[model samples]
Target: MTQRADVVVVGGGQSGLAAGYHLRRLGVDFVVLDAQSAPGGAWQHTWDSLRLFSPAAHSSLPGRLMPAQQGETYPDAGHVVDYLSDYEKRYELPVQHGAQAQAVRRDGGRFRVETEAGDWSARAVVSATGTWSRPFLPAVPGQDVFTGRRLHTVAYRRPADFAGQRVVVVGGGNSGAQIAADLALAGDVTVTWATQRPPRFLPDDIDGRTLFDVATARRRALDAGRSDTGGVASLGDIVAVPPVRAARDAGLLHAKPMFTRLTATGVQWADGSRSDADAIIWCTGFRPALAHLAPLGLRGPRGHIPTAGTRAVAEPRLHLLGYGDWTGPASATLIGVGRPARDAARDIAQQLSS
Candidate 1:
């Protein structure tokens, strides 16, 4: 069956919902397609101990502010899941769960979205699929031959699952630090945290709100064509969240130079030093989830679809939301996605009317 709308949103996560909020306000005919069977998007897939970088009140969607959880400053993943699940209903966004978008193509000067459920034709398409689905793992010498278990960030669940094992957690990002700390503090595992470069921890007081402000400043300066101070990258990598801070204070989060190669049972360093391990966790990160947009063939050398603001540069009818700085400053965040979403909706409204 072919359904039709003014705009077809290809993701039903925070970014998609934000677009829905604005589109609804404009009284545009739109529908949100979510691959997941339920709401919460990628938040439902996070590790058990994971928590937000800021309080609920500061982390929110456009139409509604996320309510604070009692007895928790930075709420856990479960809280975020509950919030997102409730958000769609509270706003009455027209979202179809289990509607995995397979591809997007141009048809009749419009866009047709082929999905698991059926097909949707729209004057404009919003590809808001975020990055959680495509976890990245770098190649290393002997990585293929390693007998022990190797897993990426997406596969990691709870530290308790690795109990009593010697684990080598690789990558210098927030995931690596948090997972290593989680293992050291909670799991009965010996963790050797490794990174290409030393991980930088932000000041304890710095959180998502401050990061958003810095991104805003950077965007403003760049728009004005002025010399810009680097945004979030300038501050540091890790935000000393409670778990990471606790582990660091306890001297359990020391990071060593990354191993040069993976051995049969563990990893070997460049200095001929080695650590035996039962498993290796790759906390590297992810690429944006945009495979469904591959049919459009607009991705550039940087593996991103070029865009002016949120609208696709080559195809004005196609808009990319969430995805991160490439699409819009801080747009991948729950709170930061609103402006771009609103702008995208307004642009679609104008295009449809024109």
Candidate 2:
């Protein structure tokens, strides 16, 4: 027997939870299917030392503000997990854990969501499956032959495990910078930072809050027919967090250009210079985890489904929430995901009512 709901939100992460919050307010019949055994979404998989760039107040989802311990500025991953767990409990969102959605296909006027647990027929489907499950690694020459340990940021845990080894951290984003700093601080390892381009750093005062504000302003300006000056710092630019700042102070934040190829023992530079390394940590970002939506055949180039304000352009019955800015500006962040989720829920409700 096929279960039915007004909407099926695939992924019970922060994005799906936010959507559930709005849907619950509208009294809509919706179910959030989560892959994990418990709450917290992707936060449970992050490295132990990870911390939000924004303070607790700035990094909150809609409705409830994330509570921080006294004197705690930026909340760690565990804090986020706890907050998410509590938020779901407080709202009593209809989320079914361990129900991993495998595929989604249109069935008559509704959508059929096939999951590990069962099949759900929904009027609309909101894919809040964020990028945590799809860590990306750029292909370089001789990558298959590399003998050393290579890992993406998704699998990274603690720095102690990598102590006393030559480590090369790749990617110019915040993760790379932070992980490099962590490695440098944890042990007497030789840390080599590699980036495709020189890493751009936001000023000491700028954090995720400032970046969101800047993004919002830029979006407004563009919408208002004004030319954006592009002066605001990019969200991808590394922020000088306390640890990153310490790394900079200690002259360990220097970055080298990306290596030309991977050598058996390490990596080779464009100049053919080679250096031995025990491990390579790839902090490259992620692609949207949209495999469940593959049955719909909506994915465009690079696995991204074209969207307009969280609604799929080709498939109006499908709404992709919290994937990234394509769905909504700043939608991938903890605080930023709520807007799109709310909009998605409202749209889904409207569709169902109609």
Candidate 3:
């Protein structure tokens, strides 16, 4: 028999856990399904040397302080995982690790979730799976023909691995810049940052506060209708670290034109320039992975699950927490989704009670 719960939270990260906590507090029975064996989502897969730009004071889940003392430089990726593990233990949240949700469909008034573990039926569902489900690697022609090592930024850990090699760091995001700089120091790195827009960088801190605070303020402004809410492409408001600028100043980094295609030995740029490299690291970013529910007509033109203001457009019983542009202060962060979780949980509880 399929297990039944009042609500099923699909994901065991902070957002899902927060949703589960709220459900339990409201006397709503729920279960959390996570694909990973641990609570941290993408953090568990992050580069080993990665650390948060935001300090510990701002890098916290709702109702729980970050273990690091206030003003401490943001925790490393490992520290994040440890903190998340502690959070899960402290809450005693009903999370089933290694439960990969394959499909979600509405059955009558309830939603049926099919996963690797088993089937679960719930009156409401929380799709807390963040937006980075699928890495958005650019599809370049002859990409497979490349004769060098190619890896996505998600899999890249340390630059020491690429020592003494000519590296081509593609993409112009923060990850691209940081990785390219690190590699340049380690070896003869030629970072071909393919981007149409001019790059902008931010300081590590502004007035003793992190740039994440600025982002949070911008989010609040967008929500308060006092500012223009732009898409992810408009990252001017987002702070880029100073190290990126220093890398450029050190003559180790240079911007390359947009990508045209991949050749057997290297990459070709739109400006008719080509460069050979020992390896390529694609930091193109990621997209939502809802392929399991291809039948669900809930995706936007951009392939993101079209959310009707956080609630799923096609399935009201189904809700999403971190799948949009203005994900509030914590949209993609562990701290950002807490407020959204409370809002979603309240809506789900009201829907169930009524």
Candidate 4:
């Protein structure tokens, strides 16, 4: 027999947890299906040195604050993982670990959530399955023939393994800058930062918290049907973290335009300049992890399912959360995801109650 709930939250990451929090408050019967064996979600898999761009107070969920760390402005990955585990226990949210949702299909007016453990029949389904599982790598000419070690940001753990090598870090995002800085600081590797366009750096005073506020203003402006006049920073711009700022002072933040193609030994620039590299790190970002939702026939171009806010446009009973800004303004961030999760929970509660 299939288990039943009024709402089934797929992916017990920050977004899923947030959704569960609001649903519990609304007295909605729900269960969170998490693929991992323990708490922390994707934070458990990130690099050892990875730190949030915002302080603990600003990077929190709906009901609780992420406890601040001593002598640390931004908490590290392990700190976040510990906090998430504690948060789940503190709230006593019903989250089933190691229950990977394989497929979600419409069953008459309800939805069937098929997982490795068992099937769950839910009145509504909220997919908070984030993008960590799906790391994207862009195709460059002769990439297949390149013999050097290549890795995506998801697989990267630390810089110790990259010592005494020529490494090319690709992409203009925060991950790219941080990784490149890591390699440069390793003291034995030659690092080259490459991007399709020059990277935009946020002012030294700007951080993720400020970026979130900027995003909120933009969102409010859009909702009010007015152009955003706030000269807020773009979230994509690189934050001047301590390590990154130090690297800049050491003259390691210089970046070159993206190469035209990959050679067997390294990369070739548009001007025919060749840089020999022992490894390449691609920080090209990710696509939404929506493969399980394929059975619903909701995926459109670019691996995105069209949505009215977080609700699926074609299937009103389904909601996609925490993938990116497309679902909600800054929905992929810890501070930004709560708004959408709360709204989604409210909608699901209303639908089930009605």
Better of 3 and 4 by TM-score: 4
Question: Which candidate gets the maximum TM-score versus the true structure?
Answer: 1
Candidate 2 at residue 89, lDDT? 96
The per-residue C-alpha lDDT of model 1 at residue 189 equals: 89
lDDT of all predictions, in order shown?
A: 0.92, 0.89, 0.72, 0.90
lDDT of 2: 0.89
For candidate 2, lDDT tens digit of each residue in 1-354? 899998899999999999999999999998999999999999999998888989999999899999884667888899999999999999999999999999998899889999999999998899999999988988889999999999999988988888789999999889999999988887587899999999988888888888887777776777689997463454448988888988988998899999999999999999989999999999999988988988898888777898878999999889999887778878889888888788888888888888
Every model's TM-score? 0.99, 0.97, 0.88, 0.97
Task: Name the runs in model 1 displaced over 4 angstroms.
Answer: none
Q: Where's the lowest-lDDT run of ten residues in candidate 4?
A: 228-237
Output the better candidate (1/2) by TM-score.
Answer: 1
lDDT of 4: 0.90
lDDT (tens digit, per residue) of candidate 4 on 283-352: 9999889988989998887879999889999998999999987788888999999999999988988888
Output the better candidate (3/4) by lDDT.
4
Question: Could you tell me the lDDT of residue 298 within candidate 3?
Answer: 75
lDDT of 1 by residue, 1-354 (tens): 799988999989889999999999999999999999999999999999999888998889997888998999998989988999898999899999999999999888888999999999988999999999988889899988899999998899997789889999998989998999899997478999999999999999999999999998999899899987899999999989999999999999999998899999898999998888999999999998989999888988668988999999999999999999878889999889999999999999998888
lDDT of 1 at 45: 91
